[model samples]
Target: MAEIPANSLRFHVQRLPGHGAGPAVVFLHGLVVDNLSSFYCTLAVPVARAGHEAVLYDLRGHGRTERPRTGYDPGTAVRDLAALLAALRLDGHPVHLIGNSYGGTLALHAALARPDLVAGLVLIEPPLGGDWVANMIDTLSVAALGLEDGTLHSELTTLRRRKAARLAATADALLNRTSLIDDIAASRPFTPEDYGRLETPVLAVFGEHSELLPGARELARHAPHATVRILPGLGHDVLQGGTEALRHAVLERLGAVAAV
Candidate 1:
């Protein structure tokens, strides 16, 4: 893990160099309780093996990244991504973005905010426009904040032990201390016009049983260049056992990007 300063914060980053000269493929994991490790153990290595530089970083306030009390909005997230890419000199070229869960939300917002930095997008179970965004945000916030009862760490310590206890603590800090939840609630959701105006090619994957399936469909219907795929027997956690499928989707998207 590398520690880099970008957007005035120190972020934990991991990079896997690829064999080919194709555009880099950056992976972004979900919110609280998630860090670069999720992709580091799964897609990052595979993407690098497939000859695309894979960049993974801990989002602000998560993992080893410096956690501040404010600046948790979508705009701040996009700025962090932009600044990180620029700090690494990866901003000189367009890169493919593969984002899971809330990270996918950042990817979408980033592409909209800085189209020049993005080549394509691979969104796994993205929370799309409308009430989907509202509900997703509510669900995640409630789930995480529910741990603030102070019993969560003990419960996890009893089950999965120290590791789970640590995760619970992280969740506790993020939900109880930071302005993350309020920022998310106040942030703007993607409108139909946002998708209709989007020109970036997108490959959005959703599990057959995932509640995010509707959002993927809505994205496909509005985005001029978008494809939606439904993987059977999966849910919000597509990166868990669905790594192979997600890998194929990412590689296939890269191929399409290369052909362009």
Candidate 2:
């Protein structure tokens, strides 16, 4: 685990050094209120044990990374990813990508921008569809200003209030970055055409109970080379549920690459 500086942003990362040359898997975290440390604490070791280096980082405003006044756009996120990979000197190595929710969306953009830098992708329950996508982005803005005006989190219990308060604060900062909101709004979900262009192996995992099940199914249909698996009784946070099952499923997906 280490902290690396890239221009104005400081990325908190975890690297599992490998013995021989191998593809490095970088994890992109969801838009959570906590820092990147939360993700590393959960994913790094498991992924590392699977025969690849697992790298995870905090986004610009979340986690240990600095909360800049601006530059939270998805384009900036992609640039940050490229910068970090270059800083780590993993630019030439085959890259495995994993992202969830907003992070998954950013991962898609990064992979599209640097196909040669990517070997495989694992997208877990990305919210990419319908009015819900745009609505969620807009809700961030509303929730942000609403917090100040007392339109958010005024009616919850103590614990719930604390949680909502944190989310509200994060939303406030994220909403100020208009570039990010605009980029997110303009970005379309990966289409069948987009999947057709991606020859790299992919594993698209979804919680059987995820609300995005419909979208995940649609995405899988287009990804001819990708495997779509639904973990039974799992929700959005499959990582927290059924670890052994999750590990087995991930191993199954990477078995093809492991053979190579």
- For lDDT, the strongest prediction is 1
Task: Supply the global lDDT for candidate 1.
Answer: 0.87
lDDT string, candidate 1, 1-260, tens digits: 79999999999998999999989988888988999899886788888998889999999999999999998899999999999999999999999999988899899999999999999999988887567657756876787768878797988887878988998899889888898888988878787789987768999988888977777877888899999988888888788868888878878879878988
Q: Could you tell me every candidate's TM-score relative to the true structure?
A: 0.95, 0.84
Q: lDDT of all the models against the reference?
A: 0.87, 0.71
Q: Which candidate is the best by TM-score?
A: 1
lDDT of 2 by residue, 43-109 (tens): 6576677677778888887866777766766668888888888888888776888877677767777
Candidate 1 is scored at a TM of: 0.95
To one decimal, what is the Cα RMSD in angstroms of model 1 from the true structure?
Answer: 1.6
Q: Which residue window of length 10 is worst by lDDT in model 1? A: 128-137
